[model samples]
Target chain A: MNNVNLNEDQQDCLQEIINVAMGQASDQLARYLDTFVYLKVPSIEQVSAQHLSDTLKYEAQSVAVVSQGFFGYEGIRGEALLMYQPKDSDRLADLLGYEPDELSVEEQIIDLSSILTTTFLNVFASQIDNQMSYSAPRLLFSSNADNNTSSQSSISEHIQHNSFNWDTALKVKISYQVTDYSFNCDMILLIPESAIINITSVIDRILEEY
Target chain B: MSANPFCTTIAEQLNTGILILDLDYNIVEWNRFFAIHAHKDAKEVIGKNVFTAFPELPQKWFERKLSSVIQLNTQSFCSWEQRHHLFELSHTRPITTDSHFMAQNCTFLPIETDKVISHICILIEDVTDVCHYQTKLNKVLDELAKANRIDGLTQVFNRKHWEECLDKEFSRARRYDHGLALIMFDLDHFKLLNDTYGHQCGDTVLIETAQKISSLLRLCDQFGRYGGEEFAAILPETDLIGAVDVAERICKEIEKLVIKFQDKDIRISTSVGVATINPNDKRYEDLISNADLALYEAKATGRNKVCSAKEIEYILEE
Candidate 1:
């Protein structure tokens, strides 16, 4: 619908908020691992789910995937994704004293990936929502799966067929390393087009509020 | 479907305790699991106040939470991971035409079974095994951390622990703008003693030396073996004059110790160097370097003496 466009100042403000959110996420992951975790803001762009999958192709094959949906007041919707290498998952399991292969997909909530994802997303969502003075983000769903062979095709197809209602978009991709472990992950944050416009207006309102 | 008998049979066969409470917080049903775990039969528990049957559950809070099931028409769940009840349980409440509660790993879930709206169910699961393992894990970690910080031979803090303590003390001194002093000492001709006797006798001498120095220092002081035949002490809130006095006392004590090894009366001596910290000094290395220079000065002038960094610096200037 091309509902609204984010100007330069709004874009910078959004990036700054995302930076703070990712920093909190990194701290939470570090605590879960009982070791220091590093996160960096690599690039921020506006793209569709199909393009996101395409851009992350090199990492998609070898990565452990975690995704979650966020809903705010007035039907504000967005998603967050974290992609980590299998080696990273194994290291995480080792830190938690679990055998890597013993972790079951159905019982995902008890695993290190889910525990960390839940905590990270909780911190990220709170930081963003509080800054915007929006309603607290409600967690719609969460899933962590290995997208090696069987799931990749289904995910790609789902992305291709789905029609998003978002009008303005903002995307941020971060690369991070964990200390004392040979593991890394790509943290991706996606805001729907309408939400981005809402955020820009919200920021202007905040400037006036202050 | 008349599945009550089957459900009762299954509940009786299970290992964990199960209880069903109505919206009024009265015991509607009790299973063999409860009879075995709680040592109370179903007949004695049924139709009684749930808290009265246990006497351990919070009477007021339990009633209030149970009342919410029918009023809110929603399921309430509590996990044992948050805090354990009288009996650890994972509890769940299910909202349905008839409400039921399930406990998982030490929880209590009570359900409402009203005809119009049964929206709450509770479930509780025992988590004694997980709790036990967690306690054991914590104890083992505490022991491991202690072992890592202690010296194997002397039963005192080792060099690694000493360094960590020094780092903390240095930061504290700088933060509070207070004075700290370090005393470094080495046994005179310790290699010769090891050669003359044996390694075991040398260890005994080191232990004895540590004990002597520890007895002479104040309770606020910390002492640790820095390396082979070498030891270091940290005296918080002590000035240079106080540190030198303590160092001199330690040196005299060591010189007086007589060790009987293989029927030979062996007299041992130690050279000590004392240095007061400058709060502005950023690196711990500087403190150690100053102490080492003072120790060398003590050895050069004559052994069995205490030297301060200021004296060593004056000598260097001369």
Candidate 2:
């Protein structure tokens, strides 16, 4: 924990902010779906840029991923990924008012990802007291259990392409479950080394103000 | 050459199928590979809705993938393992296998305009050969496993497999408290026959004996070559009487075998021993040994006769 770029205090602070942001997002989602949203306690860990895949590893041929970029203050930006099982798409589509068929399921996934990313990033930005902007969410990369051959490379490439020269990453993982349908989704926030430094200082300022 | 390379060559000349769709899911571009494989002209597809152009495409899945790609502005992939084929293109590989449609690996990439994704491009790679080879590998592995369990000469369960079957049957009989019987038999004076004739004649006699024994066995009975000039049968749900009756029939049928070897009349007979499940028989091995002891008695009394473990028990008591 000490070796992590963010010390224990900063990591805890980040986790606290993420927990609050996740709660707000979950409540919003629960209201939108007219169903209960189960949220797992969020955890944040500092990982090397190259080791991001290990930190974000998902079961092969089992998950579909959607990611989008968010801009933070001072040249800091990171991507947020929402991953879920393909089989859950049917239930999700039904809940989101989309017909679960060959045509509209992927669109439903995007709609779900966008709503989640939007709600999470908004609360996170406001909690940290930083002005932020978000790009339209888009499908970054997807690989399933069957084609595991390229999944590792796909994740690595996505991280490498997005992470840039940032050496360390603070990976935040949160789980959301639709209680009625039993569908689960993992929301991963990859904050780069530069972004965490800025956020840590922001946490220090907030603590000092308190 | 046109100033715009994308318009001139890249999309049209790429080997893999390239399809561009606008935000409304209308087809904006169709490459040569897509046109040829799909057997449709680019002019017909360029401005039509993607779902309308390929009605057979999984519309919901395609729409979901496209929406995710467009919304996230990222690349997404679909391998043949999840869905065999995206397009309903007929298989065109030189060595076509069982698959009717072309196997594909599809990639959806967002095409951005002014920092906003205006269109999505789908890249399709024909992976029929990969799927075909994987299927063939599985089939070959299956056949190899079957070959390992079967005797090459007699086409019956090999010794190893027979032992496994006997152990399984023994446990089932004990668990269900049902009767189980074993029959152990050997050709009468097999070595003498082998010495008088050649190994070729001995092999023929062994194969014929196995055929006659197997043909008389019930479907539930398991028959296998135990070893050189020896054979065994496992009869589940059968008592000593039923086993003895089956053994007697096999002995009589084998006795009637008139195998012709180079125009010479070669007669053969088998001596059989029968044993049924009992409190004393703890394992399949114990049952087999009891049957073997009965077989030894049959050989001692005469060359061609049927002996039961109960008779051996009476003899031991005497």
Candidate 3:
């Protein structure tokens, strides 16, 4: 399991922030998709390399994942990942009125997924970061494939072994539900715990000034 | 003190529509110009979804403009010339104390206010007349482009156009690994025809000959007036044998035509040189030069005959 050392207050604050950010993200996505989107509070947990596959097994095997990097106060930097099951991907394609069968190339699929993920993440990051007067959120990277392969094995192994520094790890999870289309998936925003602490301190300082 | 009369006067005098929206996107103020052009009274539009007030706007366009303002906190503008909107408008957002937008030339600008951080302002301007005239100018330019490719006298492809055709055919031949043939022909003793029948009669014969040859050629084949008294044809996907046959046919047809000029019967003939392009050949100019050399050979051997580069090679060998 990835080590998480958050006190109750910090956990509550992080959960609230994630909730608001995800809500805003869902709203923006809904506007783009032209469909109602419902996102749920994700089940927060620490998982090891051995449990990674099991954790993903309950989710769809064929999934579209988007990842981007964020940086904030005091050297805070981490990656945000949005995952969608195959069914949700189909729904997304339908919402966009794109013929899935016609998009055969990997480059085309990645471009389409990245466009959506960038728009959503841009909104989510801006809303959360703005409260502390942070720098404008920049989208570092995005992909829509099960990219955790051999090269990422070391990082996965470290997480599974609980050997990574907890102070530098913070993970937030969000699940989506579009009941009208019967589609759902878990979205994960992973940050180093130390980065979260720094961000929280900034927010605390801003709140105190208010 | 009376509200600055300049604000009201300018707002009313503008020809394009202008509107000021609050943070909630409700109209805080509307101008007379918008009321006249949009066909809606300002009193009826205030406090309504700007989109609802302008239901004719495309949903995607409306959403994109609205989002740019709300999220980026910047003014957005759209031109009528970009597409035919109900009104040609420009939008701008104001930088003043109140969040307001002014539309000019179909653009919208929103001014931000402190209490609400009025995120957007828009401006609009109408440019329908300019767009219409621009379209007319573009059409004239297109016609001019067509005119540039045709010969003024014969209404056939000119020498300049022939070069373009040959270049295109050469590239196609190389790409498809197919044969392309160039045939160059000159009216036999054309200067004598001008001396005997007058230049006007000679010109008539040239035009008639061009018409007859063009009738025999396929749509994909290009025939052009190479210069005074000379013409060239680019036959794509045709080899030396096919080009030789076409040249002979054109020669026989021209010989049969008895042109009556100045009450005298004149018989005209042409000498043709054919060259088959090798797909491996890199330069089209070399191919044309080879065809011209063969044409010189045809004229030397006989005034009215068809000659191929291979035949010229054989004669030189002899």
Candidate 4:
């Protein structure tokens, strides 16, 4: 199948599953921030690795990107990325109750990303009745040209440099907001083509049971 | 009254200190280890708010953490590196170091009863020794890295570090289309000076020269000892005219330098060569070589003078 397109009903099912996972992730964040966290409806699409940048585009000139991989049985595996503008790194560090230093600032960002990605990934795995193993989170720097022109190409170059290659990817974009601190983050989940077959089969079973 | 015998036994004997706090932040129960380390009796601490017992605690942060555990029913953790200690407890081993306080890693977990979160348990782990050793190792590594970049005698950057800096600045300048300048100079007849006044006087002269040149350069300028009796400076965003101006000032300043050794006043001078980054230069080393050629010209055409790379090239063509 050149294009793996889900029908309207299947798409609705996938979105509902993602909504539950996003709720758990936001609850974790709300507790830490002592504020309510709001998440937008996740949008899902199937695109090639070459078009992954288009599916996951943000307007920030400088961003801190963090990624972690999770594995499930029957050849099911995927990675999630949490990215946000680093302009508020200082304020976020203070809000997280961390000492003001370069290393501490970096660690706080990593901690935030880890908590979000791991919580959401685990909850999704549980809802699907799959046991998932997680890898340590890694931080990556995403920078645009100094002139802020042609950011799309720069982002593509960065993705290519990281050697992320797959025939297809299930791209999901979920935006989170904390109203108190005016904080915004983009959580992008990319499931490889090989894992989609397993996920859809599980969804089919759920449909049959219902 | 506690209802579970096994739970009480584990709490009393566990090495990790544990404290249970009610929703009002009052201490409900504590382990033996917690009581001992805190230097407080169980009878004295129970029913008292934790903030009252430990006034030094970060109340804002602590309250937020406790509220999170209670509201979200999830565990929260803080590393020793993030916050040294939630409670100011004395170090068990006094002889370890001068630090009187213990480093702790704390975890807060919700205690649920009948499907409702009743209390929050705080677990404290002492990591003083590990933290102290880590701090010592980082200090040693920083000192080693600093020593690597400095010349043994002059205390200025060594040749390796200076070249690295120049290469970095060169690329930045080329990328942004900015100007850069290099200055290469050596003492006048340094070999003869060592022969006449002995190597000891020569050492003093080199040390005094390094100090003189360093005081004249700005912090933005990268100054280093290129080799024995030879020095170089890299100036970013400076053109040939600006480089020449700096070279002339250094020449005049060094001409007046007086080195007093064993009741003898020694005088010395330096010949300086200047080169600015030009379109013809492919790399930073190209600038270095051009400046070196200019320095040779300054020495041949009467020492104790300043020469520019373009001037030397013009004279050679004549």
Which has the greatest DockQ? 4
Error of 3 at B167 (Å): 3.2
lDDT of 1 by residue, B1-318 (tens): 126888767777876666666656677766665555565666677788766777867554445435433432323333333334444222222242121222234323334345355322334455555555554655665566667778888877899988888888888888898889999998999999899888878988988788888899898888899999889999999999999989988898899998766677778999998998975468777888889889888888788999999887787799
Cα lDDT computed for each candidate against the true fold: 0.64, 0.77, 0.64, 0.79
Error (Å) of candidate 4 at residue A14 is 10
Candidate 4, residues A16-127, lDDT tens digits: the string is 8888988887777666666787888888988776576553444333676777777887677888888878654546655555455523555566566656665677677778
lDDT for each residue of candidate 4 in B150-173, tens digit (9 for 90 to 100): 898888899998999999999998
DockQ, all candidates in order? 0.03, 0.07, 0.02, 0.11
Model 1: per-residue Cα lDDT over A1-210, one tens digit each: 334556677667767766786787666656545678777665877776566546555455455555555555443456666666555554554654445454343222223333444445455556555311112122112224432222334444455355656433677677777767776766566777757766666667645655
**What's the C-alpha lDDT at position B270 in model 2?**
91
Predicted structure with the largest lDDT when compared to the true one = 4
Candidate 1 chain A, which ten residues in sequence have the lowest lDDT sum? A131-140
lDDT, model 4: 0.79
- Candidate 3 stretches with Cα past 4 Å from truth are A1-210, B1-5, B19-29, B39-56, B68-77, B86-105, B108-122, B256-267, B279-282
Q: Between 2 and 4, whose TM-score is larger?
A: 4
lDDT score, candidate 1, position B31? 62
Q: Write the per-residue lDDT of candidate 2 for residues B1-318, one digit (tens) a residue.
A: 237867658767877888888899998877778888898876678799988898988676567557656543445666675468888986568454778888987777777678688988788888898889866765665566667678888878899989999999999999999999999988998999889999889988888888888899999899999999999999999998888998898898889889988889999899999999899888889999999999999999996889999999999999
Candidate 1 error regions (>4 Å):
A1-210, B1-14, B58-85, B88-105, B110-124, B260-265
Put the candidates in DockQ order, highest first: 4, 2, 1, 3
> How should the candidates be ordered by TM-score, best one leading?
4, 2, 1, 3
